[model samples]
Target chain A: MTTYFNEMYDSGKVRPPYARLEDWTRSMPAELREMKQAEAEALFRRIGITFAVYGEGGDPDRLIPFDMFPRVFTSGEWARLERGIKQRARALNAFLVDVYGRGEIVRAGRIPGRLVYRNAAYEKAVVGFVPSKGVYSHVVGIDLVRTGADEFFVLEDNCRTPSGVSYMLENREIMMRMFPDLFRGNRIEPVDSYPEKLRRTLASVAPTKCERDPTIVILTPGHFNSAYYEHSFLADLMGVELVEGADLFVEGEYVFMRTTEGPKRVDVIYRRVDDDYIDPLCFRPDSMLGIPGLMDVYRSGGVSICSAPGAGVADDKAVYTYVPEMIRFYLGEEPLLKNVPTWQCSKTDDCKYVLENLHELVVKEVHGSGGYGMLVGPKSTKAEIEAYRARVEADPGNYIAQPTLALSTTPTFVDEGIAPRHVDLRPYCLVGERVELVPGGLTRVALTEGSLVVNSSQGGGVKDTWVLAE
Target chain B: MILTVDHVTLYRYDRPVRGLVQSHRLMPSTCTGQRVLNWAVTVTDGLAGGAFRDGAGDWIQGWSVPGPVSEVAVTVRGTVETTDQAGVLRGHRELTPPDCYLQSTPSTRSDLALAELAATVAGHDDVLDAAHRLSGLVSEAIVYTPGATAATTTASEALALGKGVCQDHSHALLAVARQAGLPARYVSGYLLVEGDGAAEGQEAAHAWAEIWVRGLGWVGFDPANRCCPDDRYIRLGSGLDAQDAAPIRGTARGTGFEKLDVTVAVQAVQQ
Candidate 1:
């Protein structure tokens, strides 16, 4: 068994960044701790923040469990991470523009042509047309995992409308409401300006056709979507209209939102809908959720779309391995973050090794999300491993395997008392005219014992992440 | 050769619609093979919205009609000068890689029959020769029979029926070419069928297949005619399938049953 790195404690001593947390936890009795946990859940429910898990027949509006223990990172530590995150965001945007325009990276022979052009996410419609400010993926969510004291590895990149930002702000709000004294003692940076920054970032990329103040709106798939709460919350915070596909129409040259007074032209749309359902004329003809002739207007510079269509191409699982190479080629700088060593089963040698080491690796599908259709080697039963091996063998190109990472852990309030649980972080990096990232991000902790997966759909709980001020 | 085209499409709805939006790829392509002397596309009571050149080098134009109307008419008239260099598309600028066309859409997906048809081209080491053989096989497999297949018919279905129109023939050729590891796409354009060419479906608006040859770029092949596209072929646009490469795509808001009528005329003009 491998020993895990504890964030709060270092070889039986408290780490400097979490020194104050020790006294706060010890001073609170078990009853108060239990009461606080209950209070956090009530607060979350009162605010009507619920995450709907896909494929699970439980409560559709179930509240994601919240942990009271805050994940802390020192100012010095965050400075490096912020730089790395912003750099990665810039590189990702550069890669998107490159792939859609000339595919210079592919011609350079750094990445294979099949991976970029033949991927399902690559949109042929948006080729040769560049969005305003040359930015695709306006909001880049980079999932990061910590191993040793200073080793952080990127698990994946979410380029197309990554959800859970509402949780980030809500967690901080609930924490400040419950522990006012903790905020006074620690000089933690506030993430309240995130919405304002996001609004400005979006407005900065308004279409050139707009002569006056550009009107921005959030296009949602409606209240039935899993991330509906986040869409409405962000719209409310940003002071923008939240409209559905029916509320918007393609008229003349631009998209317009139907209002009580009259029709209003929308300049920029922060769409939460996927590429396939954004425009019926350009993509899936059967999609009722898309505006007709929207792609024509977009290509002609009549409007701007946040996280431009075809941005998903850069965030594909098979394409993730080339991100570091993209950073070097596009920015002419070394990558600040490290990518986990991955074995693509598409290769002959890699497939053979993955098949042999089925019990020592983690395998995931190329296009799957939400932690579905994956195999955890050490945690799975022998029958499950064998079953997954057959699936991998059936389609080698669709599977990729990675070694089981020893994820770091943080102290958590459990039924038996405070114990260590695995955790991960996802920071939402905003890219527009300028690259920006709030000091703090959402920290997800595995409530179950010894679990490395931190996806909310997979029995994971969230906590408030704090970045100290120098 | 100078070819003139007159194309008109009429759409009638049982009930009035709130609005209608349309995207058109009707303009002749710009390349060494074809030169547009004059062209115009008009819609009844419609406003020209936006226009741009796409990655596939097709000029796409948008139009919208605020409707409470029962009928809409779209008209296109153009004159183009053509000189085909043996069906090779030369001096055409496009950003999308050939690898993108290798992807199979619903109409071009290969079945077991298509895979077996592709196997006949095995051991033909020359890429251009292999492409020609695949085109010939598709021609021999599906006989040209007008009204035999609908617009939604897939390549395999057409082959199984052994009878189809130009669209089915192109789709079948695309499927077999892709199955043989050659990238292919559907090309929509005007074909001036006269005399001997009339047996080649005699359709003014024609569809064919273009396979990518390593040294020659994109080469056009009309499996329905069992011949390569020449000066009589005026290329408009290309896509993964017929629906994607359609000259006009439109949607009208309202619960109205729609009826479509189209007429196209292509003639050789005195140079």
Candidate 2:
């Protein structure tokens, strides 16, 4: 039996960051806590922010359960995480610019050439084209998990348009609305300025062709998409027009959005659409969701795309193993955050070890996400382990295994009472002309007892994360 | 050798579209093999958009035509001086690494037969010799027969049928070369065959395969003609396959049935 770290208490003593929350929970009666949970759900439904993060493909209208217990981190702790995340964002952008340019890292033999060039995510269309401000992933979402108070590891990176930021903003709003007195007592960092900061970050990377104030728009796949609510929500908050593929057209040297008055030139597009569906003439010929000839305009520096096309190459799971090496090669600095020790089944030695220890390791597909296509060693039955073993044996390169991490737990509101459940944090780090990160992030709690998967698609709930001021 | 090229493509839509956009790689390549004296590309009643050289050293241009029109004609006329360096592509400025070409597309993916053919080069110690053997094997595997295969035919299909055009030959060569662990790409260009009926009819829009040799960079091999790209071959651009290296890629808005007619003429110009 593994002993998970309890973030709220160490040796039965309340931690410093969670000290204030101890009395707040103790003073609240059971009925009052239930009512507040109901109230938080009502507020979320009213605001129409109920949608699954990361397009998990479950009920789009289903409201992810909201826990009233707020996860707290001290100013001192948050300061370190901020530095690490921002440093990671900078290094990621630097790697993108380098790979798309001379590929100095590959030339220096730090990373394999086939891993960068032959990877499915490496786009041939955007080979030599560099976006403005040299930023590829405009918004970098780093998913972090903690084992101890000071030991945190990055699970993976969401470089190409990470969703769930709307949840971060809305969770804080609800926490403030329900507990006004808590705000008066504690000095928590405000996350209301995220929209404004995101707007500034987008506008800062506008193409040089824009002679005046750049017109920005959010390009969404459509209302039927799983994250359509967040797309329109972010557009409304950022005060930018939300448009689809049909609402945009390509003219001479630029992309233009159709308006009521006339066709307006769009300088920057925060596209929620995937790269394969963003240009018909360049990528898939059957893609009706993409503007024709958009790649030509992008390559010629006529417009800018947030999270520029081909940015997915850096976040690929096989490529994810080298991000720390990228930090060393590009930034000349040691990585602030540690990567989960991974064994790529592609290697003969690693595959041999993983095959024998199928009952003790967590195996995941190289390209799968949202807690899908994974086999949890301890939780899975013998039949499940055997089935996954066959899959791993069939294609060793498609799977990677990592030791089951002892994920930390936070005090979560349960049906019986407050109990400790495993949790994870995902902070949105904005990288444009400057690197910026809001103090707070979205905290996901696995509602099931002893469950370590914190994905919303896997019965996980969310909590309002708090970064208290010093 | 000086060569002149005149190519015309006519697109007739049954119903007039709202508009049409096209990305073109029609301009001749810039390398030691070819030098363009003058070149012009005109799309009927179209506005020229952005123009830039791609990482593959191809000059790409964009054009858009606002429609309510029935027919659009794209005309290309250029004069290029060519020299043969024994099929070696030298002095070509390209940013994409040679290994990137090893990636396979649907048209260039290998099948069992292709893999078997790729194994024939096992005894050759020299990569150049091995590449030449692969080209010779592909030329023998698929005989040059026009109209036997369509534009969408894959290398596997062409190898099985044993009859195809230059596109199929090039795709087949790309498949076998890549399967043999050699980086290869499809090269599209014009072949001036003097008075040959095949060159004037079906082979004018010629395509070949270029294999990456470690010391020699890229070396051209024309399996259809059973020779290397010489002074008679005017190289335009290259890609993973024929569709990727196509001179014109276009999309027209509004529901309309489109009909295409293309005619190309390549003539040797006396200096």
Which has the greatest lDDT?
A: 1
Which ten residues in a row are the worst by lDDT in model 2 chain A? A51-60
Q: What is the lDDT of residue B220 in candidate 2?
A: 97
Model 1 C-alpha lDDT per residue in residues A1-470, reported as the tens digit of each score:
89999999999999999999999998999999989999999999999999999988799989999999999999989999999999999999999999999999999999999999999999999999899999999999999999988999999999999999999999999999999999999999999999999999999999979887889999999999999999999999999999988888888888889999899999999999999999888999999888888899989999999989999999999999999999999999999999999999999999999999989999999998878999989999999999999999999999998999999999998889999999999999999899999999999999999898888999899999999999
RMSD, every candidate, angstroms: 1.1, 1.5
Model 2: DockQ score: 0.82
Instruction: Categorize the docking of model 1.
Output: high
| Candidate 1 TM-score to native | 0.99
lDDT of 1 at A25: 92
Across all candidates, what is each one's fraction of true contacts kept?
A: 0.78, 0.75
lDDT (C-alpha) at residue B115 in model 1:
94
Residues B1-271 of candidate 2 have per-residue lDDT tens digits of 9999999999999999999999999988888978899899999999999999998999999999987878999999989989988999989998988888999999999999999999998667799999888999999999888789999999999999999989999999999999989999999889886655455355577899999999889999999888898999888899989888888999899889999999999898776
Error of 2 at A326 (Å): 1.3
For model 2, the docking class works out as high
The per-model DockQ list reads 0.85, 0.82
